[model samples]
Target: MAKRQVQTTKIDGKRVRIVTTTGANGTRVQVTEAEPKEWELQAAQVRALRGMPEYGKQFLLAGDQNSAKRGPRAQMEASAAGMTPGEADMRIYIAGGQLRMIENKVGRGRLSPAQVDRHAALARMGFTVDVLRAVTTEDAAHQAVALVRGWLAENDNQSGQGQPRCSSTACA
Candidate 1:
């Protein structure tokens, strides 16, 4: 028997670990399971935010295969199909007038380099971007609502209009 060897590598910029062992049968290789990525967790939070009657219909999931699980081949195909990098996770409409983008993050999760670049591009195009992070889903939701309300108010003020009102069906 020979001592086991361990090493780390990166796939798609995410860290992965590999181990190799030698025996009478030659060498065997094993890869450790990667930790759950933040996208799914953040997606669940997005769903929760959308489920709320107050703001549910105002948001739509954006970006590539938001809730779908994909393998390497699928990812390659998506890229080949012209998927844009760093798209915001959610698109939100406020007061039926303003369009905004929301990027959701979970524990210690930060935007990737591509995301940072995309955000800048979108901002240059005069888009509103918001990042939400909180200790709890409820807190995030409240913060999002407050941000939207403030945006609506500011837009109204700039347009020389009074405060915008919310309707039963939409945030008008």
Candidate 2:
């Protein structure tokens, strides 16, 4: 039997790396997943964000499809500990902005209020934050997007922009 090859795929945002090793039969036998904590949320957000029409194709085509990487602080520490920047967290590329820090996590992890506050701090620092839930239904994703859009919109207005309000009951 011929030996199979190992393949690496970007996790949809190049935040981390996914490696798949093939068996002798040429089928994938194992998969490895790794992501930096800070970029995890951003990656998840981008993943969820990609489901929307506005950002889907662009996000997919941006060539940044990988698992999340360590935060700037962590990466710097890692460097001091003797590692390359590539070994650091995958940077988040927001529109018209330099790559920024991001936060990502997978599964149904309940976020505490304090945690959310910390996340906000990261946001203030221009880092995108993402929280991945087990969210089993498409409706859940839709509801989440609606909620976030409304939140951002409202905040935008509060800070002085006539952003259109969402009138959907699902969002109200």
> In candidate 1, what are the lDDT values of residues 1-172, reduced to their tens digit?
6879988788777667788999888999988744334555455556665666545443343434443467989878887987667877767655445677877675467878888998999999999668876645556667766665676567667766633346665444
Q: Give TM-scores for every candidate, taking all chains together and pairing residue i with residue i.
A: 0.53, 0.29
lDDT of 2 by residue, 1-172 (tens): 5455555566665533434455566655555554334333444555565666634211221323222267888767766975532221233333222233322234544555655665577678766554434323343345445544554455455655533334566324
Q: How much RMSD separates candidate 2 from the native structure?
A: 12.9
Pick the lDDT winner: 1
The total of clashing pairs for model 1 equals 0
- Model 1, residue 14: displacement in angstroms? 25
Runs of candidate 1 exceeding 4 Å displacement: 1-69, 80-82, 95-97, 159-172
Candidate 1 Cα deviation (angstroms), residue 151: 2.3
Q: Looking at model 1, which ten-residue stretch has the lowest summed lDDT?
A: 58-67
What Cα-based lDDT does every candidate model obtain?
0.65, 0.44
> In model 2, where do residues sit more than 4 Å from their true spots?
1-105, 109-132, 135-140, 162-172
Question: Residue 88 deviation, candidate 2, in Å?
Answer: 13
Output the number of the TM-score-best candidate.
Answer: 1
